[model samples]
Structure formats: structure tokens, C-alpha cells
Target: MKTLDFWFDTVSPYAYLAFERLPQALEGISYSVRYRPLLFGALLKHWGQLGPAEFEPKRAWTLRQVHWQARELGVELALPAQHPFNPLALQRLALACGDVDGLPNRRVVEALFHHVWRGGGADASDPARLQALQAELRPALDPQGGEVKQRLRALTEEAIALGLFGVPTIAFEGKLFWGLDALPMLRAAMLGDAWFDGPWNEVARPQPGVRRR
Candidate 1:
């Protein structure tokens, strides 16, 4: 069976949106999904780029776009009080949930995404909240333990080595499909469809308000 590696951060609204829709969207597809939780802030720092929330215009547009996209997907979306909350413990909690192939673990990940994005629980960095979530998610494994912390760091490093620059990246057979917009393209690729041969060309049009030299 083919596997699709999905890297995501709980802090990313786009990731939340994608996660909510993927199970249903991929209903007919013959592929196994593997969710890899990683720290998006670390990736951003390594890439020397500012996140969408770093700029006012981008942040405003992103917030609006997420809501619009959620409506389009028929999924309810609510923004957290903090745009970019710390997701270290959350990532570790995801690891503690065990294999992504299991329904319980997948559900826990989905629940966490909903808690942050739809539930408006905000402040994932808070130890109390993280602990509560970890317990509620998977009490058997210790998310705050040293082993899980190391495992989370290792996963982040592995993602960096895999050329993952952003969350919600879908990888299969050494090819990567980035962002929610790329989901269709990834599906096409899986079906052996050449949907992205080249960029579309456009003809230039005359401007009515331009002054002649």
C-alpha cells in the first residue's frame, strides 16, 4: 500500500482546515495517511521567513481566507485568541498518541486541532492545558516526559531533512505537494494524471489609462 506523509503543526489554521476535510476528501483514494506533528515555528526560523501573523495585512487576509475556506468546505472555523501559540507540547502529545494509522490517535490529533482552531481554547503553551490535553488524548504515554520531548525534536529534525518548509505538506514517492491548494494536484499525481505540465500563458492587453510616449 502507498503512504502519504502529512506534516502539520497545530498552530496552522490551514493545517486544521486540511485535516478536517482530508478523511472525507480522500474517501475513494487508495492511500494511507501518516500524520507527522512538527513545530512550525522551528521550520519558519530555519527558513528565515516570517509567518503570516508577523505582518498585519497577511494576518488579516489569512484569518479571512481561513473562514471563507472553512465555509466552502462546510467545516466550522473559529480563530484562537493567539495567532501563533506554542505547539511544542502539542507536538509531543501527538507523538504520545502512538501510530497515526490507528483511529484513536488520528481522532486525538483531530480533536486537538479542533480545540485550538474551533474551540478557541488558545494558549496551548500553558502547561496546565497541555497536560490536560495530553492526558485526555493519551494517558498511557507521558507527553511531557523526556523521551517524548526528544522524540518530538527528532521528528522536527527529520522534517527539516526532508525539505519540508511548511506545514500540511503531503509527500509520497519522494514527491512533495505543499499547502491545501496542492491537494488536488497530489490526487492527480497519484492517479498518474499530468495536470501540471506548465504554467498557463496569457496575452497582453492594452491599458486604457496609459499615456503614449
Candidate 2:
């Protein structure tokens, strides 16, 4: 059986959208889904890319699109009061919870998604709320847990190495499909379809010696 790496960041609205539908979308499929918790902030920093919230216009448009897409998909979604809350603890908690290839980790994913996106509290970043979550999940997650933090960092670095620049990316058999919009394409690739056999377009190859300007 093949395994697909699902790289996600808890604070990402798009990730939340994918989280809601991924299971059903993947139903009857032969792939094993492994939920990997990674830091989107770190990726942005590494690539020197601006986050959606850092640019006001894109942020507004993206949020609107998110709502529309959620409704179109019939998935319940709500934006947190804070757009880019700290994701360190969330990632760590996920690591502490163990593998999400099964039921227990699924619940943790849903609960964290709800806590940050659907719930109006926007308290997932609050230390008190984090403690409450840690207590409730009973996952042996210490907010200051060292090993879990390292694990999360390692996963984020692994994502970078895998050529990932965003959340909700699915990596299967060395092929990467990014964003919820790419899910269908990913499914096709997973099913051994011919759509993936040829080049879709041509672009310039990266010149490492030349500076990007």
C-alpha cells in the first residue's frame, strides 16, 4: 500500500477546508493518509514569501473565496478573529498526539481545527486555552515539551526538502499536489491515469548561481 504525506498548518483556512473533506474525498482510495503537522510561518520565512494576511488585499479576497468555497463544498467553516495566530503549540500538540493515519489522530485534527477556525473564541493561541486543550486531549503534550517541538520542526524542514511551499499539500510517490484545488488532480495521479504522463507547460529552470531579482 502507498502512503501520502498530508502536510498541514493549523492556522491555515485552506488547510481547514481540506481537512473537512479529505477523508470523504479519499474514501475507497488505496492510499494511506499520514497527517503531518508543519509550520507555515517557517516555510514562508524560508522562501521569503508573504503570507495572505501580510498583504491586505489578498487577505480580504482569500477570506471571501474561502467562504464561498466552503459553502460550495457544503462544509461548515468559520474564520477566527485572529488571522495568523501562533501555530507552534498546535503543531507540537499534533506531534504529541501521535500518527493521524487513524481514528484517534483524526479526532485531534478535527478538534484543533474547530478550536482555531470554527470557534469564535480565537483562544487557541492563549496559554490558558492551550492548557485546557492539552488537558482535554490527554495526549501527554506539555506546552513546553521539547521532543515534540523538535519533531514539528523536523517535519517542517522535511516539507521544505520535499519542495512544498504551502499547506494541505499531498505527496505521493514523489509527486506533489498543492492546495485543496489540487486534490482532484492528486486523485487522478494516484489512480494511474494518463493525465499525468505529459508536460502541461514549460518554464525556466532555476539557476542557483543567479540571484532572484
Candidate 3:
């Protein structure tokens, strides 16, 4: 079976949106999905490439763009006051849960995303807060929902070894699709056997003629 390797961090809001929709997008497609969790911020540091919103101008533009895109896509999102929070533990937990059938741990991931963007879950750095979150959801913070901490840790380390440095990176048949905007392309690739052979198969090609302004 074709495999869709999904790489993401728990704190990534866009990743959250994608996670909520991907399975439906892949329903008719022939493929197996795999999750590879990693540290979002840490990965960026290793590549010398900062995130999309590191600058003032970009940040301002991004907020507007995010709002516009969210409206069009029907997913609401905003940078919460509690942003840049530590999502290491959450990612570890997600990595573990990624393997279980039906992704039972997705509820927690979805909840964390909503908690961060929809409300005040952004300030959830305190361990007690996570514990409380756990008590409210699954029993004792893991594995009950098919959550696996140890494997997630290994997967994060594996991602580091694979030279990965971004959240929402999907590797299909050795091709990597990074970022949310790439989701459509990913869906197209996923649904088609000619994913690597289509006329517009420029996903991995070099377009030197297309100049960047």
C-alpha cells in the first residue's frame, strides 16, 4: 500500500487544522498514513531558517492572511498570547498515539490546538495544567487513548536524524510536502497514482525561470 508519512508538532495550529481534515481528504485514496512527530521550534533553529513570522512586516501580513485563509477554509485561528509555549510533551504524546488505529489520540491533539487558539490554552506551560487537561480527558495523561510516549521520543530523534526541520511535513514516496499551503498539493498527490508523474508535477522540481520578487 502507498504510505503517507505525516510529520508535525503538537503546537502547530495549521497542523492542527490539517490533522482535522486529512483523513477525509484521503478516504478514497489508496494509502497508509504514518505520523512522525518532532520539535517544531528546535528543528527550525538547526536550519538557520526562521519560521514564517519572525519579522514584523511578515508577521503583520501573516495575521491578515491567516484570517483570510481561515475564513475561506472555515477554520478559525489566531496567534494566542500564550504562543511560543513548550509543546515538547504534547508532541511526544502525539508521536506515541500516531500509531494506534483510528488515531484515538487525535482528540487530545485537537483539544490542545483548540485550547491554544480558541481560548486560553496557550498559557498551558505548567505541568499541573497538563495534568488537569489529562484528568479531564484520558486517564492519567496517556496510552489509554493509544498514546505512546517512548516511540514518540524516538520518532522526534529520528526526524532530527532525517534532516527534518519543520512541522506539517508529509513525506509520500520519498517526496516531502512542507507547510499547510502544501496540503492541496498533498491531497492531489495522495489521490493520484501519477502523483509523481503528472504534468504539473513540479512539487520536487527546480523552476529557475520563476523569479522570486
Candidate 4:
């Protein structure tokens, strides 16, 4: 069986969508997923890029796209009251739910995603709501503890080292399939499709003829 590292940030609508669609996307594949929570803002910073929500026009388009995608995928998704809110607390909470390996269980990950996506335009960072979620989780570790904070940081650093620049990335067989749209390709890769043997590797070798300033 293959192990898929599902790297995500709770702040990403695409991540929530991907999480909801993942099971159906890989129905017959023999693989286990490790839920990894990381800071998406940190990733954007590292890549010297702005998040989709950081730009006005892009933010509008992104919101529309994600909502359309949710409906198409038959998943429930509501944009939070705010876009690109700090996800540090959510990341820490997820790490606090980890057992020895610092990887949260699927249940914990799912609960977090639902908390952010299911509430109808709710404030994801609201203290009262977070308190209720904490009570519900009853995590074995303290979400506010230094250990959990350090773990979150370490995971983000590790993600950067692995060349990950975005959330909802699935790392399998040493290759990364990024975003919700990439799920079909991911499924194809898992099935050992012959196209990956040549075209996949060949596609990356093309040299750019022009440079943007």
C-alpha cells in the first residue's frame, strides 16, 4: 500500500473541497493518508508570491470558483466570514490532536475542515466557536502549548523543504499533485498509468523561451 501525505491548511477552501472529494477520488486505491496541517501563508511567503485572496480580482474569482467546485463535487462549503484569516490556531489544534508521529488523525482533520467550511459565513477565528471546537475535540495535548507551536513551525519548514508551495497537496511516490483540480491526475498516478513513465517527466524539462520581469 502507498502512503499519501495530505498536506493542507484549514484556511484553504480548496483544501476543504479536496478533503471532501478525496475518498471518492481514490476509491479502489490501496493507500493510507497522513493528514498534515501547515501554515499556508508561510508557504506563500517562502515562495515570494501573494495568495489568491491577497489580490482583489483573484480573490473574487477564487471564491466563485471554489463555490462552483463544491457544488459540482456535491460537497458542502461556505466561505468563512473572512478570507485569509490567520490559521495558526487551527494548525496548532490539529497538531495537538496528533499521536506520537505529529500527524493528526483523519477524524480530527475532518472536524477542523468542517468547522471552517460548513458554518454559513461564520467567523472561523471567533474565540467562542474555537472554544466549543476545543471542548469537542478534548485533545490529548494543549493546543496553545509551546510543543504544538513548534511542531506546526517544523511541519511548515519541512513542507518548504519538500518543495511544496501550496495547500491541498498530495505527496505520493516522491511526486506532488497539487490543488483539488489535480485529484484526477493523482488518481491516475496511483493506478500506475503508463503516461507517467514518459510524458510526465518529459513535460518538466522544457526551457522557458521568455522571462517575465
Candidate 5:
């Protein structure tokens, strides 16, 4: 079976969006999804960029687009109290959950995304918050916090070694599909379904009821 390398940081709005939609979106498929948890700062360091809000126009545009998608997805998203919540523990906890045998990693990841993105909760850094999240997610994960945290450190190091740059990245075979907008293309690639082949903006005037993707 084909596997998708699902990389995401909790702070990313797009990642937040994908977390809510991925499972059902890929139902009936033959692919396994693996979560690759990493720190956003590590990747941003490569581009010499700080957080998004500091970037003005880009942040403004992104907020607008994210809000639009949030409304479309019907998920409540408040402006986070701060940007770039410390992701170390969060990633570690996820790694622990991922390591659990027969545990639902995707479901827990979805819950983490919802908690972080929907409630403006700071999860990546807060152990209590992370503990609460794990409890609400799965009993098996809730009991393995220490081991999970230890494994998270290892995963972070692994992410650095993998040359990971960002979150919400979907990798299949050896190719990486970045962002939620790429989900359709990733789905297509897996199913041998090609919706677009040539120019993307060919339809200057689209039908009234038709939605792209």
C-alpha cells in the first residue's frame, strides 16, 4: 500500500484546516498516512523568516484566506493569542501517540489540530494542555506521556535530518505535496485521477454553480 508522509506544524492555519478534513477526504483509498511532526521555527530558519504576523501584507492576505476556508470548512478558529506556540512537546506527544501499537494517530492528530486551531489553545508548549488533549483523544496515549515526550525529541531530530521545511506536507513515493490545496492533486496521484493536465486558469469564466476542486 502507498503511504502519505503527513507533515504539519500546529501553528499553521492551512495545516489546521487539513487536520480537520483529511480522514474522510481520503476514505475508501488504499493508502496509509504517516504523521511527521516537526518544529515550524526550524524550517523558517532556512528562509530567514520570523512569524507570519511580522510580515504584514502576506499575513493579512493569509488571514483573509484562512478565515474564508475556515468558514467553508465550518470549523471555529479564533485569532491565536500568540503566534508559533512551542511545538516541541506537542510534536513529541504526537510521536508517542504515533508509536503506540493499534492506536489511532490520525484521530489524535485531528483532535490536536482542532484544539489548537479551533479554540486558540496553546498546545505545542503546554504539557498540561497536551495531557488534557491526550486524555480526551485516547486512553492508551494518555498513559504514555513520558515515553511519548522522549520520543518526540527524537522525532524532532529526525525531522531536521530529513531536511523538512514546513508543515501540512504530503509525501507519496518520493514526492512532496505541500499545503491543503495540494490534497486534491495528492488524491489524484494516488487514484490515477488527473483533473488538470494543462493550463490551470483556462476557464476565465466558470459556470455559476461549479466549484474548483
Candidate 6:
């Protein structure tokens, strides 16, 4: 079976949508997904770019777009009380639920996503709600421990090393498919479509005519 590394950050509404739609997108494919939760803020800092929510106009556009996309895709999504909230706690908790190889429990992943995306405008970073989630998870590792924190850092570093600048990216066969819209392309690649062997590589060969300062 093929293994796909799914990199996500709960702070992203698109990631939540992708997580919910992934199973249906990959139907009939023999593949296993390894959920890798990382801090979206860290990625933004590392790449020297601001997140959509950090930019005023883009934030508004992103909010509207995600809600519209969710409706079109028939997936449930509700923005939390705050955008760009701290996701460190959730990421650590997800790591604590992992096995020895650090493969997080899919159920726990889903629960965390629901906490953020389906909380009906509740504060995802609220201490009480987080504690409740921790109690519900009964994680194998200590979510508040140093080891979990280090592991989260390691994972974020690994993602950066792999050249990932965004959440909801699926890494398959050394190629990265980014965004919820790329699911169809991922499916095509998984099915070994020959178009990837031709235009996929050829398309990247074009250089930009104008440089932005």
C-alpha cells in the first residue's frame, strides 16, 4: 500500500475541510495516511511570509472563500471565535496521542479538528475547552511535557526541510500536492496517470519574465 504524509495545522479552515473530504477523495485507493500536525505560524515565520489571517483583505477573502467552498463541497465548517489563534496546545496534544512511530490516532485528529472547526464560534484556545479535550483524549504521552513540545518542534522543522510552506499538503512519492483544491490532482497522481510524466514536469520549467522586488 502507498503511504501519504498529510501535513496539516488545525488553525487553517482549509485543512479541516481537506481532512473531512480526504477519505472520499481517495476512495478505492490502497493507501495509508500518516497525519503530521505542525504549527502554521512556524511555517509562516520560517518562510518569511504572513498568513492569510495576518493580512486584512486576504483574511476577509479567505473567510468568505472557505465558507463558500465548504458549502459547495457539502462539508460542515464553522470558523472559531478567533482567527490565527495559538495552535501549539492542539499540536502537542495530537503528538501525545501518537504511537511509537509517532503516527497520531486518527480519531484524536478528528476530535481536535472538530474542536476547532465545529465549535460554533467558540474559542478554540480557551483553557477550559482545551482541558476538556485533553481529558477526552487520555493521550498516551504527556501533552504538556517537554518531549511532546520537542517532537512538535521536530515535526515543524522536518516540514520546513521538506520545503512545505503551507498546511493541508499531501506528500506522496516525493511530490507535494498543496491545498484542498489539489485533491483531484493527488488522486490522479496516485492512480499513476501519465499526464504527470509529461506536462507536470514540463510546466515547472518556465521561468518568470518579471521579478517582484
Every candidate's CA RMSD = 6.6, 3.0, 4.9, 1.1, 8.3, 1.2
lDDT of 3 by residue, 61-174 (tens): 765676676677787676666545677766654543443352325566676666556654346556776666655555433542334555555666777777677878888866
Residue 175, model 5, lDDT: 59
**Would you give me the overall lDDT of model 4?**
0.92
> For candidate 6, what is the TM-score?
0.96
Between candidates 2 and 4, name the one with more favorable lDDT.
4
| Candidates by lDDT, descending order | 6, 4, 2, 1, 5, 3
Pick the winner on TM-score between candidates 1 and 5.
1
Per-residue lDDT tens digits of candidate 1, residues 52-132?
A: 877999999999998899999999888887777677767777877776332135677887887787666456566676667
Clashing pairs in 5: 92-152
**TM-score, cand. 2 vs. native:** 0.88
Ranking by TM-score: 4, 6, 2, 1, 3, 5
TM for candidate 1 is 0.84
lDDT of 3 at 166: 82
What does candidate 6's lDDT look like per residue over 14-90, in tens digits? 99999999999999999998999999898999988899999899999999999999999998888999997999899
Model 1 poorest ten-residue lDDT run: 195-204
RMSD of 1: 6.6
lDDT of each: 0.77, 0.79, 0.65, 0.92, 0.68, 0.93
Misplaced by over 4 Å in model 6 are none
Per-prediction TM-score: 0.84, 0.88, 0.72, 0.96, 0.71, 0.96
Total backbone clashes of candidate 4, pairs 3 or more residues apart or in separate chains: 0
- The CA lDDT at 208 in model 4 is 91
lDDT of 5 by residue, 1-213 (tens): 778878877778888888777765677787777777777776777556566745878878888898898898777877565554565655655665664442237777777676677666444446676667766655445334676655555655666666666677877766567787877777777786543343333654566797453
Q: Per-residue alpha-carbon lDDT of model 2 for 1-213, expressed as tens digits?
A: 768878888888888998898867777787666788899998999999988877889989988998899999998777777777788887778778875432226688888888787776466688787878878787855546787778877888989998899888988888888898988888778778875665422223445797875
Candidate 6: what lDDT?
0.93
Which lDDT value does model 4 have at 177?
Answer: 93
